[model samples]
Target: MKKEWVFGTVIGISLVLGACGAASTSDDYDPNEAGAEDIEPDMAGFVMDQDENRILVVTPMDEETAKEGRAMWVSEAPEGLWIGKQVEVWVDGAIAESFPEQATAERVQELEMSEVEGADLKASEALSTALSEADRENILAVELLAFDQQADQWTVKLKERGDSQGEWKTIVKDEK
Candidate 1:
C-alpha cells in the first residue's frame, strides 16, 4: 500500500511540472532577447509624452474609481505620430510592474480622424515635409515634434528606432 501511494504521488508531481512547461506563453519569446517582435498595441490612446526613446500613450480607464488614465510605452513611434495624435498599439509582453507600468509596443497605427476630431492639417503637412527633408541615414524616427506652451518653443527629438545613435533637437516655435 505505501509503495503504490508513493509512486502515484511522484507521477502526479511529474505530470504537473510537465504541463506547466508545455503551457508557458513565453516559450516563443525571450524577455532578454535583443530584438523581440514589435507589439501591436492592444490598448489605444493619444500620444502623451514622447520622452526617453519611448512614446507614452494615455489610455482611458473603464472604472470611475480607477485612475482616469493609464500610461503605456511604445519603443518605436509610427510614421506621423506626434503629440495630440491618436494611436493604437499592441505590446510584445506584459507592462513593467512599477508605479507607472510600461510595455514595449510591437505595432503602432495612427488613428484616422475627421476634421471635427481636431485633426491638425497644417501641422501634418509640415511634418511630412520635414520628414522627407531629414537626413534618412541619421534619423531613424521622429519621436516627437510638439509645441511647449510653457517654454514657448517647439520640441523636436529624433532617435534610432531600430539600431542607430539617438539624437535630439529643439526647433523654436517661430524658427520653423
Candidate 2:
C-alpha cells in the first residue's frame, strides 16, 4: 500500500513539473517570429524621401550605379519613418515597374539601427551633405559608406534634368 502511494505521488510531481516547463518556454516567445502566420517582408531599403501619403525607398546595387538598384514608392508608410532611416516594407499587391516603382505598403517596420563602429556623423546628416554636394535635379539613391577620423564618406547617386542615367558622386562630411 505504501509503495503504491509513493509511486503515485512521484508521478503527480513529474506531471506538474512538465506542465510548468512547457508554460515557461511558450511565454519566452520572440517578437520577430511571433507565430507561423507572420509573413516576411517583400522589400527592405533606406527611406530616401517621404510625404503625407507615400515614401520612397532605394536599394543600392553593387555595380556602382543607381540604375540597377531598385527604387519603390511605398504608400501607407507608418509614422516615425524619416529620410535615411532603414525600413522593411510588405507589399499588398502587384508592384508597378516605373522608374520609382509604386506599391501599397501592407505593413512597414522600422528596423533598429546598429551602432556604426568608429562613426560620429549621423546618417541623415550624411545624406543631406551628399545631396547638397551633388547639386543635381533628382536623387536616385544615397548610401552611407565608411567613417574616417576627419569625415564620413557617402555615395550619392543623382540624375540631371533630361538625363537617362544617374551619376554616382562621393561626398565627405566633417565630423561634428
Candidate 3:
C-alpha cells in the first residue's frame, strides 16, 4: 500500500509540473503565422489594406518605370513613381492634401469609351483630366516623407546612395 501511494503521488506531481512548465504562447507558437481557423471569425481589416504609397511613381516615369524603380529604391519610403503626367507618394494627411478630381471626373466620364478598353478607360481619362485641370496642383507619384513646419510644405526624403536607396519615411505634421 505504501509503495502504491508513493508511486501515485510521484505521478500526480510530475503531471502538475509538466503542465506548469509548459512554454508561453510565443515561445510555443508563432503569432505572425496564424491560420484562418485560429484567427477570430470576424476580424476587421484582417486582410490588411494595401499601402498605395509603397510604390511611389513620380509623374512622368510611368507605371512601367515605377515597377522597375522599386528594385532600385532603398529606405522604401522616399521614392516616387513617375506616372506619365504625375508622381505618387505616400503622405500623411497633415501636410499633403489629396483632392479628388471631382471637377474633371465628369469630363472623364464624357470622353468616348469606344476607343478605350474597359480595364483602362476610366482611369486613363481621369488621369488625363487630372493632369490638365486648372485645379491640378499636380502632386503625384513620390514618397513625400516630411511636412516641414517652417517651410509649410512636404519634404521629400529620397534615397540617393548606398544602403539608403529608398524613401526613408515621410512626415506631415502640420495640422490641416
For all predicted structures, in order, the TM-scores are 0.40, 0.61, 0.21
Q: Give me the runs in candidate 3 sitting further than 4 Å from their true place.
A: 1-4, 7-10, 13-144, 160-176
Model 1 scores a TM of 0.40
What local lDDT does model 2 show for residue 166? Answer: 48
**What is the per-residue lDDT of model 3 for residues 105-160, given as tens digits with 9 covering 90 to 100?**
00000112232222222332333332333221222333323334455443333232
lDDT of each: 0.56, 0.67, 0.30
TM-score of 3: 0.21
At residue 67, candidate 1 shows an lDDT of 34
Candidates arranged by TM-score, highest first: 2, 1, 3
Residue-wise C-alpha lDDT for candidate 2, range 1-176, written one tens digit per residue: 99999999999999999988883446555445746346678888777777776988777555455344678889987776466667788898899988778999888877776665666666555665665456444645544344455445544444332245645666665466
Q: Clash number for model 3?
A: 28
What is the C-alpha RMSD, rounded to one decimal, of candidate 2? 8.1
Residue 122 local lDDT, model 2 = 66
Q: Which ten-residue region of model 1 has the weakest summed lDDT?
A: 115-124
